[model samples]
Target: MIQDRYSLAFRLYPYARSADQDATDPVRHPVVIMGGGPVGVALALDLGLQGIPVVVLDDHEGIGQGSRAICFSKRTLEICDRYGAAGPMLDKGIAWTLGKVFHDDRKVFEFNLLPEDGHRFPAFINLQQPWFEKFLIDRVRQAQAEGAPIALRGRNRVDAVAPRDDHVLLDITTPEGPYRIAADWLIGCDGASSPLRGMLGLGFVGEVFKDSFLIADIRMKADFPTERWFWFEPWFKSGASTLLHRQPDDIWRVDFQIGWDVDRAEELKEDNIRRRLDAMLGDGVGYDIVWSSIYTFQCRRMERFRHGRVLFAGDAAHQVSPFGARGANSGLQDVDNLGWKLGMVIRGRAPEALLDSYHEERAHGADENILHSTRATDFITPKTPISHVFRNAVLDLAERHAFARPLVNSGRLSVPCSYDGLSLTGVDGLGGPDRTRPGSPCPDAPLGDGFLLPRLGGDFVILAIDAEAPETMTQDGVTARRLAVSAAQDPSGALAARYLGAAPGAVYLIRPDQHVVARWAQYDETALRAALRRACAKE
Candidate 1:
C-alpha cells in the first residue's frame, strides 16, 4: 500500500521556535515553489539556471497518469529549449504541422501553421504530460548532478503557509518527517484546489461551465491521419461533442462531452466507456482502453495573483477550458515571466516593486486566456437552441468564406498576448518615432552574426545604436550591451523596423524578461541609467 507520509505539523507563529536547533535548523531559499507539476518544475529549472536555489513540493508521488494538454505552442517550445529540455521533449513528442476543423461530417476549415518565415519552433507538438514530466524530472536530476541544489520533494504536502515581511514560513510534511522551510518568496503552482491561495483569502473569480468532459486514451486500430485533430459536433446519439487526436506510442486521446446531468462515476466505468467508444467508432475496429476520466471545464481566475509574499501561478491562479489548449501553455508563460524577475530580485539586482509586475502582466494574460477559452467553449457547446443555430450558421459561412478562415481557426489555438498596462512599456512619454513602446516584448532582429533581442541571457539588456555606455552597464549591476543593426544589411526589413524603427540611432532598454523598459531615438545616458536604476530597484 502507498502510505501517505506525514513529516511536519508546525504551526504559524510570529517568531521562530528556536534559533539553535541544528546545523541546518531551517534552510531558507530565495524562492520556494509549492507543487511539483510542470509549471513548478519549469520555474525551478529557470531559476536554477540563473543560479538561484529552489525547493519544489508536491503531494503526489509521481507525474499524473494519461495524456493531458498534449499541444505545445511555439513559445512554450522556445522556453523549454531555453531550459535545455526541448531536445528530449521534441524527440518524444509528435510534431504536427496541420490542423483540420470539421462540421456536419465535412471539412469546414483547415490551418497550416508552418509559417513561411517567422517562428523558431514549429507551430505545435503533441506530447503526453506524463512523458513530459519524466523529461523534466530527468533535467532536474541532471542539474542536481552538476551541483545545482534544486530539491524535488514529492510525497510532501504543504500543511500551512505564513507570509513574513522578509520571507514566507512553510509547514510541510514529507516521509522523512515534518519540516519547516523559510523562503524569500513562495509561489503556489498547486493547481485548482490550491491550499496556499485559499489560505491567503484570494478568490478565484470566474464561471464554471455546466458541461463535463470525459477524456480517454486508448490503443485503437484505425487509419486516422495523425497530423489532424478532428472535432465532431452532435458527435453521437446522446448529442455529445467529440474531439480526437493521435498521440505518441500509437495511442489516441478522445475527449467526449458528457452532459452536466450525467453521473461521473458511471461515465468513468471502463466497460461503459468502451461500449460508448465502440458505438461511436462502429464495431470492426480493434482497440484497448488505456485510461479514462471525467473533468468539468472552468474559466476562472484568481482575484489577485499575489497576496503579500505568496504568489499564485498556473491553474492555482486561473483555469481555462481545454478547447484551446490555453491552460498549461499559459501557465508555462507565467513561470517564464516570473522566474527571471524572482531571480533578479533575490540577487539584489531588482527592487521588490518589480514583484508586483508579475500580477500585473500575468493576470492580464490569464484573463485574456479565460475570455478566449470561454468564448471557444461557448462556440463549441451551444447551450440553447438559438446558440446552436448561430453556431451552425457561423460554421456554414466559414466553409465558403475565405476571410472567415482565420476567425474559425483562432478558436482552437493559442497566441501571444500583448502586455498593454505595463509601466515599463514606455508608450506615452518616450520621445521616439512611436515605434518602440515600453512594456512591449523586445522585438527580435538579425544581428551581424546572430539574433539580437533574445540574446540577453536571463538578464537585463540595453540596446544602443550610438549611445555612450552608462557606468552601470558594466557587470556591477545588470548586464547591458549595444546592438547596432544597420539598415543597409537588413535582410528582413519588417523585423529590423520592429526594434530599430525608422530612426538611424536609437536606444532600447530591455528587462530581464525581455520586455522593453524604455526606448529613445537618440543616446540619453542619464535616462537610460535612470531606467536601469528603476529596474534594478525592483529587486
Candidate 2:
C-alpha cells in the first residue's frame, strides 16, 4: 500500500520471501543499511566492491517520481568512477560549465565553473535523481553478478530498532509477515525524516528558513542552452527568484521562490502552477508538468553522526538547503569517506577507533556545507529591507566590478571538503602545490593515455613522482603499494603541475579513498610507515 505514494520508475527490488523469514533466530549481517536511496545504495556498492558483505533495506521497491536532485559535481563523478558507476551517468547526463546570474531584467555576470581543464569529468552534470539511483542500482547488480556479496531487500520496513552493546536489533515488517534481524553495524541512510533516528531518540538541531520554493519538473522543447541560469526578482514577475536547469529526456527543472506565506495546496494545483510558468515562459511556450513540490530551506544537522554501532549518513546525519546541490553530492562523499575506514575496521586491519574518523571528518564537512547553505539562504531570502538594499547593491555592482562579483551568491556550487589539519591527516613536509596538500582529495591528472585516479584503486598508494620510494611499505598490517611516475609520463604537463608544482620531486602517502594523507619531497621508509599508521589510526 505504501507503493501508492510513489510512481515507481524501476521495480528494482520487489518484496520476496527470504530464508530469514523462516529462521528461528534473527538473521545477522555484517553491515545493514536502512533506506535504499542514493547514499545507502552507493555505500552498499562501495562496500560490496571491497568484498564486504552489506545488506540494504528499503521500505519501497525502487526510485520514486520526481527529479529531486539534478546536479552532480565533478568530485561525485570521480568517486563513482572508482566503483565503475560513473560511465553511464557521464554518458546520459547533460554537462554544463557556464552559469549566468541575473538581477531583475539585466544580466549581472556569468562564471565558468571549470575554466582550465585537462580533467576527465566536467564541472557538473544535470541528471534526473531517478536515473542517478537507477545507475547506482545497475552497478550494484553488475557487481552482484560478478560475485560481490550484496543484498537489496525491498518492502522490508524497520518497525523498531533496539540498540545492543555489540550489535543492533531491527524489527522489520513486510507484506508476508514480520521478521527480526541483527547487524554488527547499522547505518541510517533513511534520509532527513529518518525512522531509525527517531527510534534512537536523536534529533537534528538547526534553523529552518521561513520562505518556501516550488520545484516543477516539466517536459519542454525549448532551446535553453545546457547551462545554469539564476535570476533574482525576475522580469517574468513569477516569483522573488528563479532557477533553471536542463536535465535529460527533454525535461527542464524550474524552481520559483514563491515567498514565505502562501497556500500550500493552492500553489501545487496544476492550473495555478501553470499560471506562474506562463508568465515566465511566455504565452506561447508549452510544457507538461512532470512533477512538483514545495519546500522550505533548512540548514541543520545532527549533533553527532555516530551513535555506538549505529552510524548515520547522508541526509540522516546532516541536511542543508538544496540551492548548492549539496544534498546528494555530499551523501556520495560520505560514502567515499566512510566506506574505506569501515571496511578496514571490519577486516581487523585497523583499530576500531578508526571508525571515529568518519564522524570527525564528515562532521567537519557537514558543518562547512551547513555554513554555506545558511549564508546562501540568508542572502537569497533577505529578512529586512536594509539587507535587501545591500543585496541589490551588491548585485548592481557585480555587473561591472570584478571584485563585487564574488559577493553575488546565487548558490556556491558543490566542492570537495578538505580534511586538512584534521585528526587523521599526517605531516605535510613537502612544499608542493597547495592543492595537493595533505587531506586534500587528489586532483585528477592525465597519465599517459588514461587518468591518474583510476590507477589509485581503492587502497593505500604511495605516489612517487620523480622521487625514489620502495616498491611497497606496510605498517600494522595495512600495506601501501608504490605508484612511481615521472614527469615524462604526462605529455600535457598537468600531472607534474598538479602534483609537484615548483618542487623538483615529491612523494605522497595516499589513503584508500584517494585522499593525500601525507606528502614529502623525498621518500623515507620510517616516515612512510608512521604516516600509514596515522592514517589507519594505529598511532
Candidate 3:
C-alpha cells in the first residue's frame, strides 16, 4: 500500500461519534458521497453552496502522501474558480504554457497551449494532488463555518450498498461500530478501484494497455523551466520514454516509460531508481526521492454512470490514462455537469428525468477521454514494428515540417469537451462565435473589473451582451437573472470578440454549470422561457 510508505500526513477529519451512528433507525440524507477525494469534496462544496445537504464518507481522514496528480488543465481551474477554491490552488501551483516534445536527444516540436491573452488562468498548473484536495477541504471548512449544509465523516468506510427504486441504502463501518444510512441520491466518487461500484456488481468495460510507467517525485534544486518536457527514447537510456514536470516546494515529477516485461520488484529497488536518476541528472547531482511508484493505466468506463438513484462520478464512472491529465480533469467536469442538474431536481425545480442527461452527457465525455487516451497510449507505446516506424517517421517530420507537427501527439493535454447536439442543448440562433455555441462552456474574457466568468456566477443566467434583457425571469419554477454587459466594458475587445463576432449584439441562456444552452441576436422572452424549460428537461 502506498499509505504504508508515508505517515498520516493529513488528519483533517478524524473519526468522531456522529448522532446518526446511534440512531435506532437508519438515518437519511438528501445526498451521500462515497469518497472524500477531490471530486467528492468538490461536489460537496458545490452542493453545499447551493443549500443542498451532502455527507461525504471516507475511510481515511485527509490527503495521503504522494505527488499523485500534478497537472491541472485550465478548464479545471476555471471550474474550481467557480467554487471559490482556485485562489489557493493558483497561488501554490506552478503555471506553465509551453510543452516540448523530443525525439531521442533532439527536439522534435514545441507547442504553446495558451497563446492568446485575456483569460484569467494559464494553460496548466502543476500542483501535487494532496495540496489540491487540501485547498478544497479548506474551502469546505469555510463554507461550513458560514452555515453550509455539508458533513465530512472520516474513518467511515461503506461496506455495502443497497439500491432501492427511489433511494439507496448504505451500510457504513466506522471506528466505533457499524451503522446503516439511506441517501435520497448516492454519488460514487470513490476511485478507479471503486468499492461502491463493485458492491453494486458493476464493471468497467474498455481497453488496458500492456505498458507501464514509473513515476518518481524527487525534491531537488534543479534549474528546470516550468514546462512539460516529453522525450521519446531518451538519450539517458533509462527507459523507452521520459516526461518531466515541475511542482511547488522544489518537487519535480519524472515519469519513465519502463516496458511491461520488466520485473517490478527489481525496478523499484532504491539503487535501480538512483541509477536511472544519476544517468539523467549526471553524477553527483543530489536529490531526495519524495515518492516513487509504478502505474499501469486503462481506458475504461461504465456503460452507464447512473443506476437508479445512484450515480457515479470521477474514476468510479470512468478512467483514462494519465497521459492527457484527463483523469482528474474529466472527473471534475462530471461533477460540474451533474451538480446543477442534481441540485434542481433535489429542490423540486426540475423533474427526475433531468438526471438521465447526466449519464448521457458524461458518458459521452467518458468515451471521448477513453478514445484520446487510447490513441496517446498507442502512440507512446507502439505495439508493432510498423506502427513504431510510422511513429518515428512522424516525429522526424515534425522536427522540420510544420504540417507534421500536428501529427506528433505527446499526449493531447486536456481540453474541455463540447456537448454540441446533445439533448439539453437548445437553439443557437445568434450565429455568433463558434466557441460560445450552444452546449459549449463559456470562454473566459476580460471585463471591466475582473474576468468574465466570475461575473456569470453559479446559476442559470441570461448573459445579455450589448443587448436588452429583463432583470430576472422565472420559468417552470426556476429563475434566471440577466447579467448585462456591453462591449465597451472590456477595453481589450475580448468580450465582443468572444461572445459577439460581427453580430450587433447577442443574448445567451447559460446553465448553472456555465454551459451555453441557447443564444439569440435579440432577447425574446418566449424563446428564453422555452430554452430554460429545455435546459431543465421540462420540455
TM-score for each predicted model, relative to the true structure: 0.86, 0.99, 0.98
Write down the lDDT that model 2 would get. Answer: 0.92
Q: Model 1: number of clashes?
A: 15
Note the residue pairs that clash in candidate 3: none
Where does model 3 exceed 4 Å of error? 1-7
Tens digits of per-residue lDDT, candidate 2, 446-480, equal 88888898889899999999999999987878889
Instruction: Put down candidate 1 lDDT per residue, 128-196, tens digits, no spaces.
Output: 887777787788888888877687766667888888898998877655556787888899999888888
Superposed Cα deviation of residue 401, candidate 3 (Å): 0.5
The candidates, ranked best first by lDDT, are 2, 3, 1
Candidate 1: deviation at residue 511, Å? Answer: 2.6
Model 3 quality (TM-score): 0.98
- Misplaced by over 4 Å in model 1 are 1-25, 232-239, 406-412, 428-438, 442-454, 463-476, 483-494, 497-507, 520-523, 533-539
- Per-residue CA lDDT of model 3 for 334-393, tens digit only, reads 989999999999999999989999998999988888888888888999999999999999
Preferred candidate (lDDT higher): 1 or 2? 2
Q: Give the range where candidate 3 is weakest over 10 consecutive residues by summed lDDT.
A: 1-10
Worst 10 residues of 1 by lDDT: 8-17
Ranking by TM-score: 2, 3, 1
List all candidate RMSDs to the true structure. Answer: 5.3, 1.0, 1.5
